[model samples]
Target chain A: MPARADATSPWRSVLAPSWSLGRGADPLPTFVWPVASAVLLAAAWSLAAGRFDVTVFPSPLAVAREAMRMAADGTIWEHAGISAARLAAGFAIGGAVAVPVGLAMGLSPFFRRMMEPFTEFFRFIPAIAMVVFALIWFGIGEASKLFLIAYNAFFSIAMATEMGVARVERSRINAVLSLGGSRRDTALLVVLPSVVPYILQGMRIGMGRAFATIVSAEILAANAGLGYLIYSAREFSRMDTVVVAIVALGLLGLAADRAFVAIARRLYRHTLPEEFGP
Target chain B: MIRARFVEMVLPYLLSVAIMLGLWQLAATQVNPLFFPRLETVWRSFWSLASGDLGAQILVSLARILAGFGIASLAAVPIGLLMGTVPAVHRLLGGPVDFFRFIPPIAMIVLAVAWFGASDVAIVFLIGFSTIFIVTINTEAGVLHVVRNRIRAAQMMGAGFWQVFWLVVLPSAIPHALIGMRIAMGAAFSTIVSAEMIAGDYGLGYLLQEARTTLRTGNIFVGIVLLGMLGIMTDRVFRFLIDRFGGEHAGSR
Candidate 1:
């Protein structure tokens, strides 16, 4: 249903200022709305936490205390560092391999045909299944964790790279070829520029998958990392610690995503598309 | 030409499978049978699962996936529409929602367990939560992209708010919503195995885990195959629905 910001509706009138929706200089009022919303959300959370009086549902204050405790004990930083390092490692490795392989598949029909079945089959196999093999192959160490993340990252990047290559203007390639450009030169000059945006997009996607895999792999079997911290907290019913870990996860994930987009925007300032998500 | 076209498509797939099986069979014979089951053994295992209690496990897993995916759509689509239609609301909620979207669902599994306990509801919620953001963003984009002129025209023509939304926004957004749902379905399926791995006593994931522990390579292989087949079928159904709606929408266009 189309929602009416009707004059008669007091809730709308009070909650949403009339002039905020207007054009030009009026957008400022609307821009500040989320601050009010943040306050409201926090208040609601506090109220619900208090009202419920549930053991698992720790109040915000309690979570803050737990956060402080973890900080004081120095375990939080250790776990956070471990998780971050793993994510970085996996993302770098996965991006490197996947982008190259994806480019190859996209540019070469023979390569695509050869790799298609393996990629499709492996794509369907859950990372958990790979963890079993990783444990067997890498012996339950950081390698296993990195391998899982790398594997997860590979598919997203590969798909994106293939898409980017497929979408390269055919005319541009033909023009380059007509100009006596070699295959390598055509790929470097014509294809790479067009595919850069998609490669970045694929990296963004791969980061999400890599992060997910890292956390899950860590949680499944690890002595260190934020995943292990949360698992440990859960084991002891330390709801506050668990909450803090989750909040940290949310923050890190958000930060990594924003950082990628910021870099992409900065690099591709001229040709950047406005709408992108997922 | 038709037969040749059919053969062209089929031959590559067959060749790939035959090569894979031949390699696996070689390894199975050379290596230990327990570690690397032969293709024939895996086929037998697949049939056994189809005929036995394994079918229930597959059904249970499918039910969980459907439940999670269904609930996510119900929650995401309406809210996405609201955000899409209202610029102010979208601006406000978009940042926070996007933040939550990136947080790996597995990271939240610990919280999910604590919040809802190790029950089916928690598993379903985890799967749903994992997939919701993609659907929300997609749906909102879909709705927002609905031609502004259409909305304005509807408003000008004595259409009420609801009527304008129903007549103009909903139809335009359906295609996007469907795409989001399809993607989210993939996400839901991707996460279901992990959710089941952690919390369930019975499911395809649970069965796969058991197979791993027992070193029943054949059974594990069978489980993996089923996961792929199930995922493909789920996608096919989603596509069918999209095409059905898309055809009518296309006619209008």
Candidate 2:
């Protein structure tokens, strides 16, 4: 296959370039639109909170105060730190296992045929539904939470890796073989580097899935994470705290996504085309 | 050659299943039954539940997913089209949509419960809210990426704006919209389970949560298996529809 064909892997489309903030066009409206929208939403929310009871919908100001209180007591930091740690651990474990297995499946027809059905079957099973099984097997400890997140990340990353490897140009492999390179050398020098962007894209997607899984897992059973914080606060009708936790979760997700994009760009800058840049 | 190909495809799949089951059986014998029920027992539980309320639970969950996905598609398609075609609207809404999309649906469960309580509305809202963004984004991308020459040709033919959109744009966008729907379906299914597990009295998720509380390892397995089956079934149905009606772009992906 042509080398250009290899660049058209579906994962590239999935990792679409981040929205440009207008190249050389006017920047004022680009800046103003988001600010205006945020102000509008906050005003609407404040009005609704004023019209309704604070118990039902806490105002932005109320949530800010609650956030301040939680920050002062370091509650937000403690929960955020724990949640981040869990996400990091789960993502690392899942990505490490998934990439190699996926590569094997893609490289060997026997392994691919042997594993494809099982992977396809399990991929459909949402990680959230596994919460009960996870609880029963791993209990209400950190292991269960980690298992859930890792399970999510594993499938996503594995799928991407497999696809990436499968899409590697035949000519590239032939070229390497013609050069008298061993299989291991071909894999290390040609296959691995070619799939790095795809793997990074997979990890970014997997990170999002892991974060979502950890939230639900913590909400259902845990004692200390942000999900747990939101759930417990909800039980006590602390809408402000619930709102705070939700906002924190959103911010955390955004930060992680941006960080993943940054790292992917840096690692794959030399390899990927400009259009794929973050 | 045909027979060899058939074996090449089917034999390994069957063997994989057998191996997985064999491993499960072996592990079950070594582990506590309370934590890891025998595969046979789990199969039995699945059979029993299949004959009983498992059907109803599955139906309930499916209905919720369909409802949420349907609503999301209805709202998102037009808006996504508008955003894709109209730069002004895209500019106005893009930032907010981008910001909100990062907020995981699971994180909104508490807020959902607060707003709508532990009822069907809350569950449906969670699923719909979670799904709309994905569908919208996909639909927008679909419209944005429609062949510019096609639109120009239609316009040059004296086709009105509406005619160009209806005849050229909508058809071109269907494949991506269908893909978005598929993605939304998966999102809806998963979100519904999380919502139900957290705060519903019925559905497969509720069954799983209930089984967890009762320490019924067999029932938990049954719930999981049913969910997997349902997920596959829905995915297959979407595939069938896309194959039958998705036009030229049906097989593009």
Clashing pairs in 1: none
Winning candidate number (lDDT): 2
Give a tens-digit lDDT track for model 2, residues A62-150. Answer: 99999999999999999999999999998888888999999999899889999988788888888988887788788789999888988
- The backbone clash count of each candidate, in order, is 0, 0
Q: How well is each residue in A183-235 modelled by candidate 1, as lDDT tens digits?
A: 99989998888787887787776776666677777777899998888787777
DockQ-derived CAPRI band for the predicted complex in model 2: acceptable
* Interface DockQ of each model: 0.44, 0.48
Off by over 4 Å in 1: A1-31, A52-54, A273-278, B1-9, B31-35, B247-253
What tens digits encode model 2's per-residue C-alpha lDDT throughout B8-95? 8888988998998888888889877776789889989888888888888888988888888889889999888877765556666777
List fnat, each candidate.
0.38, 0.59
Off by over 4 Å in 2: A1-29, A270-278, B244-249
